[model samples]
Target: MKTDADAAPLPMLYRLYTAGAQIASPILDRMARKKLQRAGVSKARLHERAGVASQERPLGKLLWIHAVSVGETLSILDVIKELRQQAPRMTVLLTTTTTTSAELASKRLPEGCIHQFAPLDTPAATKRFLDHWQPDLVTFVESEIWPHQIASVHDAEIPLALINARLSEKSLMSWGKRADLARALFGRFSLVLCQTDPVRDGLRAFVQEPWKVVTSGDLKKSSDPLPVNDLQKARLAQAIAERPFWLASSTHAGEEEAMSAAHKHFVAQHADGLMILLPRHPERGPEIADMLRTEGWRVAMRSKDEAIAPDTQIYLADTLGETGLFYSLSTLVFIGGSFVPVGGHNPYEPAHMGCAILHGPLYANFAQAYADMAEQEASMEVADAAALGQALCALWGDDEVALLQANAKFYIEASRNIRKDVAGHLLALIAP
Candidate 1:
């Protein structure tokens, strides 16, 4: 009856449980495909044979980075770039959970890094993946701690670290249920680089050695500004054309309706105002457009290459990996997903883009960053949809609000070097 955390291998019953879980995932996958369409990601099988072939090529020391999604991948991109520059001969293995993450990582990864799908938590798959990659040092971005994967790395006698790690209250509560198991799994890591004091405190509660966790600030703060080519900037500028525009970027399900309402409110005041809605998930684009259209707003979906005409009320930024475009074009930006209990999307991107910022009240995920911005008057928090509309209207009507925009610009400018600070800390941990 040994639990997964016990050093002893997962037991037969646990194996059956894991197998059942894997089988159940396909049913969820089918449902996701029906409900989410293009946003649904199928589980990827590890290319064990190909991985083994690459391992046999006599590559030098391998450093493996596992990032779950686009955010995590982008968060650690600077660190990866820095690590490569410092150790030119070191081979890097990048693993991601989703196909979108993998695709984005593939496009952005430097010359020496190889991208692969991380294996499922099943023992056999984990073992196969570990056997092929033979990573010398393993670092996970954020909190994607897989029990079997950590155990497999420990079994392989490889060093492990968790960088930019943060645990939500809900997640911490779930782990508290199996504290002993959590401790055992987390104890295998040589270091846990936490993002903030709260994250460090949470990890300390579950780990055997409290000092193993270090606070290094969130890596999201340090990410290089999203690249905007000159052509794209000009095109976006031409499309926007001095229209008072506010971007609701990385919006979640409940937030879109709120944004649509806010857009209508702004339109009432400034007839030339634009509301650019970037849903967090691309699949939600069509659905959101339909909803907005139903509300009598003229909608232009980005995927359809529709231009934002003078009368277009809402521009649906429905594509992937182009949030930068929307953020840059925006005079003011609202970080979405906070209106409901979805935690919130990253505000740093828009802040860094020098746009006046607004977000909903629920931003526990980026609490520290948001607190700093709020204190500095670099960002504003709205209580509900009504406040959201009010904030947008005020910013659109007044030219003096540009002072608040300047504060946001200054905040981002001053903090851009956080990546260098974090990269230095991470390298010392891994290579030292």
Candidate 2:
């Protein structure tokens, strides 16, 4: 069972990368502090970015899992719960790189799991983190390929796995260009559970052993539907009973204007049509509201406790961890981050809640997932505001939305084995 950590000589690129990281540690730490501050890390907790733990590590075999953001974080919560079920004495340490993900982790991470801000990928920071935590196994989510941290964990002889692994077309090409570096990094992993067969094929070329990379299916598809607050769902359902409303969810900066234009088109025929705008970042609620107001739209802010009045054309759901509630409220959902080049948000969230899904064309990150949905006619794609408006108008018809939703349910059921397979592989990796 010897891996790169045991038998392979360090690739020349790997040697240079670790050495460069060592030399750049001081500068990287300072830069990380500035970036963390801007991401809303408090002054007291800033050192967490430098690999300093704010709380004491628990005594026992620890499984360290790193997921870079909210989507990645959510994909693994159920996995953590599964892990705890099999190994009650094993504690899990989850690390993330963003404030929103940290917030989500605080509210949703299962028992026996703790969250921390991940260390910067520099030699000093990774060393500090590894020395303090001393995890028995480590796992990374998606495309988090930090050389220093991976190398540190490997050098410490911790079993490392990359679960729900994927690389965009662009990233795969980039890695292909640097074969040595890719091998050096990918070789260290004891296993790589890819999101799709294509991802496994794309990653296999770089790994020293083909068995290390296997397709386990997309974890997002297998994740539990976004949790809803029943009380809140009931209250909101009562407030907007029988209204024709759609949700523009997890929208980025540039996509909001497109959403606004589409909403305008929807209301032209049905004047009472409502658009629930949920931006990706909750902090930008005020800015989004102001912009919509200037466009002559009546906007009601969720964070402000404003009621969804009859005159309110756009209800701004700018709160955190309530997407499930919003998803439940709408029949047709336009998942944002697609109109722009953010590779789109997870469509699984909306699909699981029985919402007919729509998105723009830039979904390379979730290519297979989107393609599978499109094949089943479970999701629709729009190129811009005009196309979005047309789709919205068409999908609002009861018959049209129901067909898409039925297809979406079919896609979900077909993929039900994904989580079980992923959990089984992870359980094997983390087994003592």
lDDT of each: 0.76, 0.86
In model 2, the clashing pairs are: none
> Candidate 1, clashing residue pairs?
none
TM-score of each: 0.86, 0.92
Q: List, residue by residue over 22-131, the lDDT tens digit for candidate 1.
A: 66644543443343235443323324311222234236788888898888999988888888887778878888766678679868999888877665565555666677
Tell me model 2's lDDT, rounded to 2 decimals. Answer: 0.86
- Show where candidate 2 strays beyond 4 Å: 1-8, 31-46
Alpha-carbon shift of residue 191 in model 1 (angstroms): 0.5
Candidate 1 stretches greater than 4 Å from native:
1-58, 397-400, 429-432
Q: 1-432, model 2: which lDDT tens digit per residue?
A: 223554245577877877887888788888878887888887877888789988788998898999999879888888887788878888899999888898989888888888899998877788888989988888999999998787778877778899999887778999899877787788889999998898899999987689989999888888888779999998888888788889999999998999999998899867889999999998999999999999999999999999988788999999988998888777899999998888888988888888899999998778888998999899999989989988888778759889999898788877777777776786677545
TM-score of 1: 0.86
